[model samples]
Target: MTSQVEKRLAGLGLELPPDWTPRGQFLPFRKDGVLVYLSGQICEWAGEVTHTGPVADTPEGIAAAKEAAKICALNLIYRLREACEGDLDRVDVILRLGGFVNCHSGFPSSPAVINGATEVFIALFGDDGWHARTAVGVSGLPGNASVEVDAIVRLKD
Candidate 1:
């Protein structure tokens, strides 16, 4: 059966990628009670790591970083599918999102970049995707990715 999320993705011309493969010791997500905590996902697509390096503070440069942030959101969507056992309808709400941008020194627009990810979720789940968020600039991220995002999701009982 096609999940609601799958249908939503289809409408957006997107599809969930394969099950997330953890690159390190930590699991991609851990569930406790009705909540799922997702680990930080970097900008990776189709086995290729995209959008590396520090984001500049210009319009064009920040746009590129925002695109990277979108990719990270897609990665989280796939991982969320796994956590829900392929049934995204079980998702109750997106509780929170934490975004980190590998930005140039003095760059202060991380929240703008992270909005790329936030917008996607809102499109997919409507108000259920609206959540608390934190966007911050960091010196660097693993694999030098331009953006990374982690999420807190609540699932239906």
Candidate 2:
């Protein structure tokens, strides 16, 4: 049966990425009791990195970062689904998210760039998606991705 979360994703014209492999030597998510911790997900689509390079305030850079953030969110959602055993309705709460943006030294718009991923969760889960978040600017990220996102999620006990 299609889960409510799946329905919501469909409603948003979003689909889970086909591949959920970890980008490096780590599990995609680790579950402890009811809490599931997701590893950082870079902006990738169909097994290819979608965006790379430093984020700047320029219109093009911002647009690219936003797109990258969205892709990371999509990847994170897929991990969330996996954590729930393929049933997104099992998600009880979205606890937190940490976003990292590769940018020029001292860039101040990391939060806005990470919002691309933040907005996706809010759109998918509504109030339940609201969570504490941290957005940091970094000189580089694994794969040199423009944005990387990690999430903390809760599942029904």
Candidate 3:
């Protein structure tokens, strides 16, 4: 049976990718009671980095970084589904998101870039998707990804 979340994803023309294995030694997600914590996800798909290098601090750079953030969101959604046993409807709420953007010093648009991920969750889950978030500029990230996002989710019992 198609879950409500799956239906919503279809409505948005979004498809989750196949199961992903962490390239590093870290776990993708960890569950404690009803909460699931997702590790940081970058803008990579099918084993290729969609966007590489530190984000530029120009308008065009922010736009590109936003797109990269969206990719990271998609990857996070994929992991969330896995954490939910393939049923996203089990997600009660998105508790928080931590966004990191690799950029030059003093870049002030990290929040704008991370909004790409936040918007995706809101589109998917409506009010339930609204989450506490921390968006910060970083000197570098793994693979030099433009953006990386980690999430904490609460699940329905």
Q: How many backbone clashes does candidate 1 have?
A: 0
**Model 3 RMSD in angstroms:** 1.0
Compared with the true structure, what per-residue lDDT tens digits does model 1 show for residues 67-144?
998899899988888899989889899999999999877888999999999998998888999999999999999888
| Comparison by lDDT, 1 against 2, better one | 2
State the lDDT of candidate 2 residue by residue for 81-136, as single tens digits: 88899899998889999999999888988998989999999988889999999999
Q: What is residue 125's positional error in candidate 1, in angstroms?
A: 0.6
Please list the Cα RMSD from the true structure of every candidate, rounded to 1 decimal place: 1.1, 1.0, 1.0
User: Model 2: residues >4 Å from true position, as ranges?
Assistant: none
lDDT of 3 by residue, 1-157 (tens): 7779888888989877656567689999999999999999998888777887688888999999998888898899999888998889999999999999998888999999999999989989899999999999998888778889999999999
Model 2, residue pairs in steric clash: none
Error of 1 at 6 (Å): 1.2
Model 1 CA lDDT for position 74: 91
When summed lDDT is taken over every stretch of 10 residues in candidate 3, the lowest stretch is 14-23
Provide the lowest-lDDT 10-residue window in model 2: 15-24
